[model samples]
Every structure is written in structure tokens, then in C-alpha cells.
Target chain A: MATVTILGKELAVDADGNLANLSDWNEDIAREMAAQDGIPNLTSQHWAILNYMRKVFEKEGSAPSIRRLTKESGVDTKTLYQLFPKGPAKRAAKIAGLPKPVGCI
Target chain B: MPSETEFQPIQKVSIVISKGSLDGVYPGLIMANGARMEGIEASLFFTFFGLDAILKKRMDNLKVATVGNPGMHMPTLLGALPGMSAFATKMMKKEIEKIDIPPVGEFLTMIHDSGAELYACRATVDMYHLKREDFTPELDGIISVGQFYEKAAGGQIIFT
Candidate 1:
């Protein structure tokens, strides 16, 4: 496990840097996490997908995979890549303070 | 002592599907899909019998390998029986569905929609006299072996 500091509060993240406990998630934490990932600013599109992911995770107990995210998040694959960079599901889930999604590679 | 970490980044991956059977197509699909999900460019080349994989009607109707398959766990004699392969395919499909994994057709759509390029072998296309109409609209086009190499250049090329 690794740790990320958000709002001066330290929280443990999984090996992939996704938050291990969803309760530690909030907009402030998400902003910090996004900054850590090289994005100093979060666009409305990023927040849309992140909030959708967080909502689904809070209800389902797991972050959505890229497949589910692309299908239902109203974000196309190319746009998701543009916003999330290296990997959408992993990065978005991390910023949303959700655990790593198990379904993706 | 060498460090335990190496940061090798994959810019692209070309996955070749040589077999059309259900077992054969999935590996290439999974790898390419994985690469695309990782934000790496992915390309798929289907050759020989594997061209059946992209055929609009047969792509989703592939059969599990039963005949002479060591992993199938059945006697060779039983493996020769009709419907055995279909039965195994059914069982595999059910399990895959239970895991929320998309079926073959839907998976292909997902990967294609995700920006992964799909190609078919020109030799196979010529031999079969196959037209573009024979395949799914997602088919990028039929390319020669040399063209495949060109496309695979500067990327990890995997033969499956």
C-alpha cells in the first residue's frame, strides 16, 4: 500500500494509488489527487466522469471498469483518454478516491 | 544489484489472431483491449482461418476447442462427438457472462469503439475471395503481411 496526503490528512492508497477507503474521498481530496497526476486543474468533464464513478462505487462497492465507464459514463473512449491520460479507469478511480477496478487489465 | 523497477512504456501493441476458435480469438482480443485500456495504441491483425473471427456472422459464434485439446479434460473419443465443442462453448459463455464480461461481438465493438484498429489478412481475403461486405463494419481493411509489419513497427508485436 501507498499513501497520499489530501488536505493535510494522510490516507493509505492501494498499490495502484487508489484510495483504500472510500470515506476519505471528497472534492478537496480529488483535487489533490488530480494534481498529483499532473493535472493542476480539473475540468467540468473530468468532474462529471469522476462524480459518476464515485456515485457508482458508493452504490456498488467497486469502481467501474473502462468497459462500463465507456458504456455508461457518457464519455467516449477517446475523450476519456484525453482527460485521464495514461489510463481512464485507473486514473479516474484514483482521483475519485475509489479502489482500483478489478475488471481492467 | 539491479533495481526491481523498470519503467518500460508501451506505445502500441499489434496482436495477431491466427486461430478462429473461441479460445484463440479471446487472447488477442483481451491483450489488445488491455493495451487500449492502458491508453496504449492497439492494432489487431487476423490471419488465415482467424479471418473468420471478424466475419459479421461467425465472429460471435466461434466454438470452443475440444478436439485434441489437452486442457479440455475429456477423452479423445468423447471429444470427437458432435455438439461437444458447442456445449463447452456454452458453458464458457455462461461463466464469462456471470463475470460481467461482454460477449465476443460486444467486446469487439467495445475495443473498436475505444480506438483500437482492426485488420484482416490480405492473403486470406484473396484466397477466400472475401469482400469487405463479408466482415463487420469495424474492419479497418485487409492488409498484406508486409503492411502488417509496417503497422506493427515501433510497437510490441504479439502473435497469438
Candidate 2:
């Protein structure tokens, strides 16, 4: 486990740097986490991906793979990488307070 | 007893795939895709028969080497029976799809879209007289072994 201070509140994160508690996540925290990751601004495109990941996680109990994200998130693979940067599925899931996706494709 | 500074994390990987069977090809594809998912640079060089993985006509129809593979757990003679390879391939494809892994064509697209470089070996392409149009559009280019070595520099090189 690890801790990150976001919005002046200390929060626990998992070993993979994902939020420990889904409820600990909010728009402010997502923005803070994104900023901490060097995405200084979260565009609506970014929110779309994050929101889609959260919705899928809520339903599926895990984050969607990159293929699913690209196919269903209304985001292409290139733009996903641009929005979340290297490892789009993993990073987007982290920012969305979802577990790391377990699928290989 | 090496110093910690000598143990830097793997930043890149160059994989050379020289076999064309479904079993032979998927390992390299999986490794390359896995590397990209880790934010590490990945490049795949398809040589010899492995070029089939990139060749549009053959990529989707790859079969498992049922006869020679000891892992098949059957007699080699029985493995040589016609339709055995097809049956095994069908079963494997089912298992692969059950796990949500895409077919070779779609998998290549996903890997390419994720920014990993895919290359077909120039020497083999020349030997086989394969034209550029014969390969998938996802291919970055046809490159020589020298070029492969150059790209592989400073990274771990894996042959599958």
C-alpha cells in the first residue's frame, strides 16, 4: 500500500498505485491524480474515458482492457494513449479508481 | 554481486519471431503486447516463416504444429492424421476466444494501435518475393537484420 495526498487529504492507494477505496475517488481527486501524473488539465475527452472506465468497473468488477476501451469508450487507441499516456488502460483505470484490468488484449 | 546501478529496469524489448505456427506466433505477440502495456518500448521482427503472421493471406489461417510438438500428448503418427491440426487449432482458438484474446488479425491491429513497432524481415521478404502490399498495413516496414539489431540496441532481445 501507498499513500498520496490529494486536495489536502491523505488517501491510501494500492501497490499498483490505484485508489484503495472506490468511494475515496471524486472528480476533484481524479483531477488531482491526473495532475499528479503530469496531465495538468483533464479535458472532456479525458473525463469520458475515466467515466466509462468507472461505469464498466462498477458493472464488471474490473477495468476494461485496452481493446474494450477503444471499441466501446468512443475513444480510439491512439487518442486513448494521448489522453492517458503510456499504458492507457492501466493508467485510466488508476485514475478512475478501478482495479487494474486483467485481460491480455 | 552487481551494484544496484547495473540493474536498471527494462526500458525496451526487441522480439524476433521466426516461427509461423499458432503456438509459435502468439507467444511473441503476447510478449510484445504485454511490453507495450507496461509503457516499455516494443518491436517485433518477423523473419523466415514467422512472416506469415504479418502476411495478409496467411495471418488468420495459422495452424498448430500438431505432429512434431511433444506437448500434444499424442503419438506423432496419430498427430499426422489429416484434420488433426485443424481440430487442434479449432480447440485452441475456442480457448483463446473464451479468454477474450482476439484473433491474430485483430490482435495485430490492437498491438500496432498501441504504438509498438511491427516489422517484417526484409531478407525473408526478398527470398520469398513478397511485396509490400502482401503484408498487413499495420506493419511499420520491411527491415533487415542489421536494422533489427540497431533497433534492438540497448534493449533485451528475445527470440521466439
Candidate 3:
């Protein structure tokens, strides 16, 4: 376990840096996490991905995979790489305040 | 010269599998999927009996290996009964599907779309008389073990 401070409040994070508690998530926290992940600014594209992941996680209890991101999340693979730089699935999920995706490398 | 801190990170993982049953194939798929999930390049090499899982016609029909298995709770005699393999496969499939995970076919599509490279063993293809058309459309290509080795060179290789 690890901890990341967001807006002066510390929250638990997983070994891979994903939020351990979904309750600790919010848009501002998302922005802070995204910045920590190397994206100092969050664009609409990043929000779109974050929103989609959080929405799916709310119902499914897990974030969607990169495959689902490209297929159903209205984002394409090339653009996803451009947005997240590297390891889009892990990075995006982390920024969205979700746990590392199940079975992720 | 590359900076000490800028040396290349591990970029790829090669998984070699020689078992073809449902149980055998899913671990390889999960590992490859897991690798891609972490932004690593993942390649699955199917050889020998493992070729059964990637065969277009048989990929979706893979059955569990229940015979002489110690891990499964059932007695070895019960493992030989008709429908046991299918029953076990169905049970496993249903369990994984509840979490929104796709079936074997769709799982392949997801991993492929996520950038995991799929490959078939050339010798296995030839030995089985399987045509290139017999594998899923996502297969990068069939290659010999030597070629696979060349591609997998330094990162990591796991035999499943």
C-alpha cells in the first residue's frame, strides 16, 4: 500500500499507485492524480476517459481494459497512446481513481 | 551513450504454451493480457498440443483437462465421466463472465485490440496441417521457434 495526497488530504493508494478507496475520488483529485502521472493538464479527452472508466467501475466494480477503452469508450488506440503517453490502461485507470485493472500486466 | 538512469526497461514478454486445453490456454491469455495492461509488449507462442487453442475452429471449443488431475476436487474416476470437461469449462466460463470479462473469442479480440501480438508456431502449423486461414485474423504470423526466440531475445520468456 502507498499514499498520495490530493488537495491536502492523504488517501491510500495501491502498490501501483491506483486509489485504494473509490470513495476518495473526485474530479479535483482526478486532476491532481493525472498531474502526478505526468499529465500536468487534463484535457477533455482525458476527462472523457476518466469519466467512462469511473462510470463503468461504478456498475462493474472494475475499470474497463484498453480494449474496451478503444472499442466502447469513444477513444481510439492511437489517440489513447497520445493522451496517456505510455501504459494508457494502467495510467488512465490510476488517474480515474480506480484500482489497477484486473489481470493487467 | 545512454545515461545510467535511461537504460531501456523491459519491453516485452514471450509466453510459450504447449498445453491446448481450456485451462491451459486461459493462463497464457491472461498473462498476455496482463502484460499489455501494464503497457508491455506481450507475445503468445503456441506450439505442440497448445496449437489446439489457437486453431480457428477449435479455439472456442477448448475443453478442460479433467483426466488424472489432482487439483480438482473430484476423484480421478469421476474426471473420466462424460460431460465432465464441458461441465467444468462452462463453470469456469460463467464465473469469469460475471465480472464483464468477455468469452474466449472476445477475450482474444480485446487483447489483440490492446496491442498484444498473437503468433502460431510454424512447426505446429505444419504438423497439424493447419492453413494460415485457420487462425484468428489477428495472428501476426506463424514463425519457427528460432524466429520466436529471435523476436523474444532479451526481455523475458515464460513457459506455460
CA lDDT of each prediction against the hidden true structure: 0.85, 0.89, 0.81
TM-score for chain A as predicted in candidate 2? 0.92
Q: Please report how far candidate 1 places residue B150 from its true position, in Å.
A: 1.3
**For residues B52-158, what per-residue lDDT tens digits would candidate 1 score against the true structure?**
78998898899998988899989988988999998999999898777666788888887887789999999999999999999989999889999999999999899
Best by DockQ: 2
What TM-score does each model's chain B reach against the true chain B?
0.95, 0.95, 0.89
DockQ of 3: 0.37
Judged by lDDT relative to the true structure, which candidate is superior, 2 or 3?
2
Give each candidate's fraction of reference contacts reproduced.
0.46, 0.59, 0.41
Enumerate the candidates' DockQ scores in order.
Answer: 0.53, 0.65, 0.37
How big is the RMSD of model 3? 5.0
Counting only residues 3 or more apart in sequence or on different chains, how many pairs clash (N, Cα, C under 3 Å) in candidate 3?
2
Model 2, A47-99: lDDT tens digits are 98999989988888877777777778798877887887777778888888877
**For the second chain of model 1, what is the TM-score against the true structure's chain B?**
0.95
